[model samples]
Target chain A: MIKPLTGNYAAAWGARLARVGVVSAYPITPQTTIVEKLAEFIERGEMDARIIRVESEHSALSAAWGAALGGVRAFTATASHGLLYMHEMLWWAAGSRIPLVMAVVTRTIGPPWNIWTDHSDIMGQRDTGWLIMMSEHNQEVLDSIIQMFKISEDPKVFLPGIVGLDGFILSHTTEPVDIPDQDVVDRFLPERRQPYILKPGDPLIMGNIPSDLRDNVKMRWDIHRSQERAKGVIRDVDREWAKLTGRSYGGLVERYRCDNAKYHIIGMGAWVGDMKEAVDILRDMGYGIGLVKVRYVRPFPGEEIAETLASSKGVIVFDRSVSPGSAGPLYLDVLSHAYIHGVRVPIQNVLAGIAGIDVGYDDIIGGVTMFINALEEGRWPLPSKIQWYFGGGEWWP
Target chain B: MSTERYLPLARPVVGVSGKTGTWRIERPVINYSKCIKCGLCWLYCPDNVIEIVEGSAEYVKIDYDYCKGCGICSNVCPTKAISMVPEG
Candidate 1:
């Protein structure tokens, strides 16, 4: 069914279609609507599930973890400070290998106290052992949430996942989204089957401390191996979704207009749409520019990114958040991928949209123009510095 | 061996590696004379290590292999038959 829905509503619909058995959530901006919709679905008898109303995000995720551990599909949603508050349980969920799905509305982390669209909240959890995927549109938000369950519950990758959408940008904005039929989604995503389940009379210990230090190391290694294995599962699930829904997001990273491009731009989430428009304008101006929208940040699509940007002369990366005293987290990942693959291209980092500053197509086009100009003027490397575009500063040293 | 590392489905297998009985600084000793065989200790053991032997002289036997000696069985015993004594 086609309907005008916000990203939060799309995610709620996705959870409903997935037939999530248990939903535990605490209300926070942008993400509150997603859970509120779930509550409505449960109360109205539209969905058969338990809505665990928790006092804090920590308990919210913990409840979901318990449900998932009991061999049932579970989901939760949070944003910004709420996600930060659930940091410890986030590790618990992933380390315990619970195939739980969480929708994170990416919001700015506060000290100055602002609620706006930024990647800092999700980026802050880069190493938390959860599979992270960002959505560009409301449709993708719905589709990715459904696919995340399949990917995370795959035998090769029994890990938790986080589906992130920009706070207020996609969360509040209404757009036309096609909700996949429940039967079609069921065909694409089967009921989750993990190796172990907590059941009465068949007792098993979970998340127990290992006696030998090597066992702990082995557990961490298993998580790492599963993360690496998830790359394939992600692609497989995307293919299945495409066959079922006629829409595929090009696996890990979606490339646009990069066939004969000399310059490329890379980013994740809603800002990638703006970058695509910027690329179009730059292409019309004969700049030979393209855009690579990184859909999955965790299990970083390094090889695919390198292959896509192999022939480009220079690439510019847009970061919505900073890593403080260093470079943008996305920029660092791209730089490492480029370095390891021996694709010695001049890559520049443009730090924009920090603390929710609006970054339009014009700002993106300007940044791309600056990078291309630098490449032509024999200053290709641009002194290896991070530039703050539309961030009230020229560059940070 | 694969089960030893991040056990699949996170199912905790029995008697695999660690003998949690080593964690017991104080072990529970059941005084069978006062034991009513009410099975409260069997019901209260968090580790599920208490087994009730109906026909034997010792009606209750604690599986020390996995018991951490939490004293829950002692606390739940109605007749004060189970006492947590310090390990020698």
Candidate 2:
């Protein structure tokens, strides 16, 4: 059914269609309505599931993890401070290889007390062993949520996942989303298969300190291998879902107008849409550039990225979150992939939307224009590798 | 990196921490004559090492492998039947 829904509603519908067994989340701004609508679904009997009202995000994820451990598909959602509060459990849920899904409406981490959209919240969890996906539209958000269950529950990738949408931008904005039929989703996402199940009489011990330190390190390596293997599983699942639902996101990284281009622009989440617009405007002006939207951050499409960078004269990367001491997180991932793939090219990082400041196509066009001019003037690897773009005609080159 | 198993799941086994009682400075000794058999020590045990042995000659049994000998049982015993004796 096609209906006008916000990103939060799309997530709730995604979980509803996936036939999740448990929904546990603490209500935070921009994320509260997601659980509220879910509670409505349960109260109205439209969906058969348990909505656990937890006191904090920590307990919320724990409850979902517990439910998943019991051979049930589980889900949860949180943002900003709530996500940080659940940080400790993040490693616990992933390190244990629990199969579940979470909707992380990305928000700015605060000290100045902001609740706007940015990648900082979800980006912070990149190393936590969960499949991270950032979507461009409300439909993609809904679709990715269902696909995540399939990817996460796959035996090859038995790890939890987070489907991220920019705060307020997607969460509150209304757009028409084609909610996948429950029967079709059921066919695509079969009955969930968990690694272990908890039974009352038959006891299973977990989380105990290992006698050998190697045993502890082995678990981390296993997760690493499974994550690499998930790259194929993600593509296969996307193809399967496309066959079933007539929608495909071009696998991990979606390339647009990248053919015969000398330069490429890269980013994730809602801003990628704006980047596309900026790329088009630049293209019309006779600039040989394209946009590469990173849909899946983990099990990163590094091979595809390196392939594109290998041909391009120069590439520009936009990051919503920075690693503080180092460069932007997304930039670092791209550079590492470029390094390993032996793709040597002039690439620069643009730091924008750090605390949810609005970044429109205008900012992208101007900033990228300067980059293109620099590359054309043989000013490759211009003075510094990073630039700060803070909208309103202000950016440091 | 791992032998037989790939995941971290383990079966509930004894002496997981390897005879933790060796770290205890004082041990609890129960006097059967003044014992109330209240099961308070069993309930109050933090490590769950104490068990109420109904028909055994000893009033209660403690799994010393996991017991830290923290003297929790002696402190909670109301009948004054349990004593924390220094380790020799």
Candidate 3:
């Protein structure tokens, strides 16, 4: 059934279709409506599940972790400071290897107190061992959440995952989403088969302290290995989902019109849509330009990124958050991947949309034009390390 | 099929099969004459080593094999019939 729904409601529909057993959440910005819809479903008898009202984001994730550990499918959602509050439990969930899913509405972290969209909150949690994937639109938001459960619960990749969409941009925006039937979803995602579960008669000891340093090191390494293995599972799940629903988001990263392009713009999340428009405008003006949308950021997709950008003369990386003193986080990863694969294309880091400043196609096109001019004039690398685009006026500290 | 990297879901052995009594520095001796059938010591024992044997001379017996000599039973006893004596 096709319905005009906000990204939040689409996420709720995704969880409902997946038949999540327990949902533990605390209300926050764009994420509140996602759980609110879940509550409505439960109250209206549309869904059968336990909704845990938590005191804080910490308790919210902790309760979800407990439920997943107790051998049931679990979910939760949060944004910005709420995600920060649940930081410690994020590591616990991943380290414990619980196959749970969380929807994070990407928001700006505040001292100035803003609830706008940015990648800082989710980017800050890049190292927490959770498989992170960003969505470009409302439909992707729903589809990614469903795919996340299947990927996370795979025995080869028994790890938690985070599905992130830009705050307000996708979360509050209304778009037509095709909600699949529950029976079709059931056929796609069967009952979770975990290697271990907490049961009454069969008591189990989990999360015990390791007695040896070697054992501790090995456990952490195992998580890393599992994440590497998850790439295959992600692709497989996407293939199966496409076979069912006729939609597939080209595995790790989706390359748009890159076959004959000389310059490429790389980005993730909602801004990718804006970048695509910019690419089209530049292409019509006889500039061989294209866009590469990064779907999954955690496993990094280094090989796919390197392969896609190999033919481009130069690449502009648009980052929504800054690493401060270093280049943008996404830029850094792209550079490292390119270097590893021996693809030495001149890459420029354009920091845009920090603190949720409105970044449109015009600003994106202007950034690409600057990169193109530099590449043509033999002035590649353009003096300064990072370029700030669309920040009102440049006030350097 | 337990890997050294992750915890196996199987239950850890419940009772200590190894003789934990070797770690006991002191043992509790019960005075049955003053002992009431309240069973407070059995409930208070941390290691669950104290068992109630109805027909025995003293209604309660401590299995020293698993007792750690914590003296929790002596501390909780209301009648003052149990004492922690140094192990020779």
In candidate 2, what are the lDDT values of residues A7-47, reduced to their tens digit?
99999999999998899999998788888989999999999
- Candidate 1 CAPRI grade: acceptable
TM-score of each candidate structure, all chains considered together: 0.88, 0.94, 0.89
Q: Candidate 1: list runs displaced more than 4 Å.
A: A390-397, B1-88
Error of 2 at B39 (Å): 2.9
RMSD of 1: 3.4
Q: Rank the candidates by TM-score, best first.
A: 2, 3, 1
Q: What pairs collide in candidate 1? A: A196-B9
Model 2: lDDT equals 0.90
The sequence of per-residue lDDT tens digits that candidate 1 reaches over residues A1-397 is 9999999999999999999999999999979999999999999999999988889999999999999989889999999999999999988888887799999999999898989989999998889899999999999999999999999889899899999999999999999999988889888887787757788988777767676777777778888888888999999888888998999998899999988988899999998898888988889999998889999998899999999878989888889999989989999999999889988887888888988998888888877887799889987667665887665335553
Tens digits of per-residue lDDT for model 3, A1-397: 9999999999999898888989999999979999999999999999999999989999999999899999889999999999999999999888888899999999999888999999999998898889999999999988998899999999888899999999999999999999988888889997886657787887677766555667667767888888888889888988999999999998888999897989899999999999999999999998999889999998789989999888889999989999988988999999999999999888999888989999989888877887799889988768764888765444222
Provide the lDDT at B85 for model 2: 89
Count of backbone clashes, every candidate in sequence? 1, 0, 0
Evaluated on the second chain alone, the candidates' TM-scores are 0.83, 0.82, 0.79
What range of 10 consecutive residues in model 3 chain A has the weakest lDDT sum?
A: A388-397
Clashing residue pairs in candidate 2 are: none
Using Cα atoms, each model's DockQ against the true complex is 0.34, 0.63, 0.37
